[model samples]
Target: MTAIGIYGSAGRMGRAIATIVETEGADVAGGVDAGGDPTALAHDADVLVDFSTPAALESHLAAAVAARTPIVIGTTGLNATHHALIDRAAGSVAVLQTGNTSLGVTLLSILVREAAQRLGPEWDIEIVEMHHRHKVDAPSGTALLLGESAAQGRGTTLGEERVDSRAGLVGARTEGTIGFASLRGGSVVGDHMVVFAGEGERIELGHRGEDRTIFARGAVKAAMWLADKPAGRYGMTEVLGL
Candidate 1:
């Protein structure tokens, strides 16, 4: 059985992963919260799952590299610098990172990409997402992930033509650009929808996460799949064989 360690163990996502470790037929190697030692837990665990804050990413990834343990990162709000760090760490240990760990969202991304590819640039692309009231990120990572999919289909990148917000006097929507809108309220777990608007018809692909358990389950499934794999980066599509 795999031994899994939890970074930010006391947080909502960490605890959610903990609750399913046994159900995954894996042992909880240990857990570490803010200010705790991740290197120690990494040394003891066969696989590490980090749902910690962006501030803790460097240390957690370094720990995974030092211990040569596979790690699955579900933490959101990562920037380019964080991605560079993960890229470096992947040279030493297997790493899987995602905005959302729900399988449904993973598949939805594929559908969004395909839709965008089938539709022409005349079909404007827009992405919208909503999370729980306590969520702190604008344009939730999952939204960005879906936007990336649409951009991929359009032969461009999200950074090239992404629009997060607009106020009065914002000009006409740019062709081939991907727009994003974010909402936070209530206890909504997660909701994402990608729209491709054409002349007469519009195509929308979406996913709703009703509970955190789905993410936890996907993380566990990813952790187990990652264990004993070659050093590299991976995504949920690989875990789901999509």
Candidate 2:
């Protein structure tokens, strides 16, 4: 039985992960929130699943490293420093990080890449995503990841050429530009669409997450897969073998 520890147990995603683990016949060793000692919780488990905030990610990664626990991180909105920490931890323990954990989303990314590669610069790429009203981040990590996929397909870097949310007086969409838009409302689980628009036609690759449990289930699967790996960094693409 895999002993799983959950960080940010009080949050929506964390609780969902715990429930999924239980339903999947895994052991819920323990969990930690802002009010608890995450290091101690991780120390007693074989693997840790983190669905916390960007601010809390560093401490969670540090705790996992200290305990020599393999971790599956599903948090988004991470900065460069956070990535550095994850990379350092991967030197000591397996670390699986993903912007989106839905298996369908991973497949969508793969298709988006293929579309971007085949469509050429004449077909402009745009990513649009929507989440619940409570979400804090804009554009979303998923949107950015999708943009990165498109950029990779175009043999470019997302950071070097991202055009996020055109505002008033924006003349026109630039050629070879990747754009992003975000929407938040109601209790939307998640929705993402990548549009490839040309002169007279449009192609859309999309994924709708009707249930949050899909993400939780994917995270659990990733944890199980990471448990047997040597110290290294991985992603959902690796998990899904895409």
Candidate 3:
């Protein structure tokens, strides 16, 4: 059985993943939380699954590389520096990272990409997302993931096309640029919708996360799938063979 070690073991996602791990017939090798020893945990398991905070990402990657263990990162709110670290770690160990791990969301990203590709540049794209009030990031990572997909279909990068906020005198929606809106509320898991608007027609694609366990289950699935893969950086799309 695959032995999966978890980072941020004290958090909700860490606990959820542990339950799913056992249900899936895998061994819960161990876990490490804040100030915990990740290098030792990595050495003890076949793979590492991180639902930890962005602040913990660097040490976790170091530990995973040090132990030559594959790792699945479900941590959100990561910036360019964090991704740079992940890219470096991927050179030495199999590393899979994603904004959202729910299989439904993974497939939704694919559909959004296809829709963007099929539609014309006249079709303006907008992404809207909502999460629990306690969640910190605006334009959640999943929103950005969907934006990236749409941009890919349009033959552009999200960096160039993404417009995450708008204020007074923001002007008309740019022809091909992707827009984002973020909402926060009580006890919400996650919700994302992508709208493609044109002159008279509209297409919207979305995924609603009803529970956190879906993410945990997917993370476990990804960790197991990544355990034996060769060193590389990967995404949920690769995990699902999409």
- Whole-model lDDT for model 2 versus the true structure? 0.89
By lDDT, the better pick of 2 and 3 is 3
Candidate 3: global Cα-lDDT?
0.93
Which window of 10 residues has the lowest lDDT sum in candidate 1?
111-120
Model 2 CA deviation exceeding 4 Å by range: none
Arrange candidates by TM-score, descending: 1, 3, 2
Clashing pairs in 2: none
Report, for every candidate in turn, its global Cα lDDT versus the true structure: 0.92, 0.89, 0.93
Question: Candidate 1: global Cα-lDDT?
Answer: 0.92
Deviation (Å) of 152 in candidate 2: 1.1
Tens digits of per-residue lDDT for model 2, 123-196: 98888999999999988988988998899988999988799888899998789999989999999989999999
User: What lDDT score is found at residue 67 in candidate 3?
Assistant: 94
Provide the RMSD of all predictions against the true structure, rounded to 1 decimal: 0.8, 1.1, 0.8
Off by over 4 Å in 1: none
Give the per-residue lDDT digits (tens) of candidate 1, residues 183-229. Answer: 89999999998988899988888899999999899998999999989
Model 3 error, position 208 (Å):
0.7
